[model samples]
Target: MDLLVETFFNLAIMREALPLLLRGVLTTLALCAVVIPLGFAGGLVLAVLGTTRSRWKRFLLACWIDFFRAVPPLVLLIFVHSGLPFAGIELTAFAAVAVAFLLNNSAYYAEIVRAGIESIGRGQREAARSTGLTATQTLTWVVLPQAVRNVLPDLLSNTIEVVKLTSIASVVALPELLYAADMARSVTYNASPIVLAAGFYLLLLWPVVRLLSRLEHRIAG
Candidate 1:
């Protein structure tokens, strides 16, 4: 028992690792703050364009979405960070992470938004139009509100996934929470830092998980 505790839960090592881990937490939060909004905005634009009647445009948009969705985010990130320099486009680690996550996450958010938009009935749009609202206005006032509400649970769930996915930023040495933990482990030769990182993650995500459950139940009810 002492051996196990020393290996995995040593308080001294955890204390030593705390400051670096805290900095990592802040970086992770900042990365999320930047990427999540960009993804959502990009997705909204794509979803809106998807409503176009032009068949060729739709085909191209669909292709764009599919290509990004099919590519693994880590591969995409590596390419953006490493491969793009060959094309004379060099991005910093943070910028590379932002761009890659934006591409990958936008596709996912687009699908969710599309699903939400489709759930709205044609009649409501027509009703809004008859009230002298332009198509954009109708979408803004009538369609989107209901659509977003309908998909609130899904959006929140996806956002949670995005938060978790930020850990992958560590691959580029962005010094996210996981990276910090790993560094601490290497330095101390103990697993306690990793365990502390897991505890931090659980603290961060557990409330959202409970809220998601409550939302799903409420939506069902």
Candidate 2:
């Protein structure tokens, strides 16, 4: 219908918005590149610390993990961006969003890594011990390798989740895909820009989702 074409298939609007959308794509990729490594590294460290016999250490990290997991991402973002300034701790909008995302991802990744490490057989630990490996050596060299292998799919799935969560950064005016689309819509007063943004998101994420699906299947088998 003409209405559908006018609303969604408008070529002029697409041409106008293409550059903004592409810039958003690059910003999003950059955010993900930073988030995945730091977040996962924090989580891995927390998970490893959680394996300790020290109950208090476990309790402290548990509290941190639970707090971040329970807080909604948007709320956390706002708190980091707005609330911290009250305590004389100032952060740029981008830094705040990145920190919030890192906290969120670290909490989830900690749990995933913990579960993976726990799933390793006790016999394997004993075998490592019998080979004259200390507990730390066994954990670092043996158990972690297998655990990381087992959790690869879950980690990739979480990375996909982090990708989607980047959209939340728009609330802070981070100019990611959603923000770019919003700007274009405000200027043009048409929904076509939003449609284009949605298409971009789909194009970016659908392949990752399918690859995740395949990884899940392979892991399961």
Candidate 3:
């Protein structure tokens, strides 16, 4: 209790934890900021591929989706960052983590996008084709617009997942939130920094979460 009071109320505590914790928050946010957009891009690409008419291509995409979805993010990070040596392409921790996060998110968003695309009324596609639209044109101008609007809620939720998953990157010494907290504890023999770190994450995450929830309600309504 006293430790909490000292940690929360003391200027010394703030001085010590603030800088390190802020760095952690920033690093975590950076990781997510990069991964989320990349994930959306990858997901859209995969979704488009999956929607193509080629049977063999769809099979390959299913395998790609299953492989990433089956593998844990931490394990995938290791395999990509460190275990790819046998393939002669060793990736940096940042590269490996970003790739892993993006791929993981890709599987999820791809499925969501697939659902969104399918959820579009069949009549819309027929109407677009009747108006002299090619399949690609129909998809780009007609199907995608409604699909994106329909799936915005799912996309935002997935973005939150991408943000939270950055904690797993600590295992690779990515200098993200958990890594920063671990470093602080190691240096100061204090758990207070970690507590502060938790507060910071919640502080950062709360507004986004609330906004997402609000958006979900608005869309659902």
Candidate 4:
């Protein structure tokens, strides 16, 4: 038991790694702040475009979304970080992460938003339009609000997945939480830093998980 504890839960190594890990937490948060908004905004635009009656437009949008969703985010990130340089488009690690995540996550968010939008009854839109509201105004005021509410659970769930996915940025040496923990582990020759990082992730995500559960139950009820 002592040996296991020392190997996996050494308090001294955890203490030593705490500051670096905290900085990593901040980086992860900042990455989320940047990418989440970008992804959501991009997704909103795509979802809105998807509402068009034009067959070609819808087909193109579907292609775009499917392409991004099909590509693994890590591979996309590596390409953005490493491959683009050959094309004379060099991006910093942070910027590359932002761009890659934006592309990958926007597809996911768009799908969720699109589903939410489709759930609204066509009668609501016709009613709103009959009231002299422009098509855009009707969508803005009537459809989107209810759509978002109906899919609130799914959006939050996707956001949680995005947060977890941010750990993959470590592969680019972005010094995110997992990367920092791995660095500390290498330096200290102890697994405690990794455990500490897991603790941080659990602390960060547990409340969201619980809240999502309550929400799902409420929605089901």
Judging by TM-score against the true structure, name the best candidate: 4
TM-score of candidate 1 to 2 decimals:
0.98
Compose the digit string of candidate 2's lDDT tens values, residues 103-172.
9999999999998999899999999999999999999989998998889889888888888899899998
Model 2 off-target regions past 4 Å?
A: none
- Clash pairs detected, candidate 1: none
Where is model 1 poorest over a 10-residue stretch in terms of lDDT?
40-49
What does candidate 1's lDDT look like per residue over 42-79, in tens digits?
88888988988899999999999999999999999999
- Candidate 1: give its CA RMSD in angstroms: 0.8
State each model's CA lDDT, in order: 0.94, 0.90, 0.85, 0.96
TM-score quality measure for candidate 4: 0.99
Mind giving the per-residue lDDT tens digits that candidate 3 earns over 36-64?
88988899989988887889999999999
TM-scores of the models, in the order given: 0.98, 0.94, 0.92, 0.99
Q: Which residue pairs clash within candidate 4?
A: none
State which candidate has the highest lDDT.
4
Global lDDT of model 2: 0.90
Q: CA shift at 178, candidate 3, in angstroms?
A: 2.0
- Between candidates 3 and 4, the one scoring higher on TM-score is 4
Q: Please, what's the RMSD in Å of model 4? A: 0.7
lDDT (Cα) of model 3: 0.85
Instruction: For candidate 2, list the clashing residue pairs, or say none.
Output: none
Clashes per candidate, residues 3 or more apart or on different chains = 0, 0, 0, 0
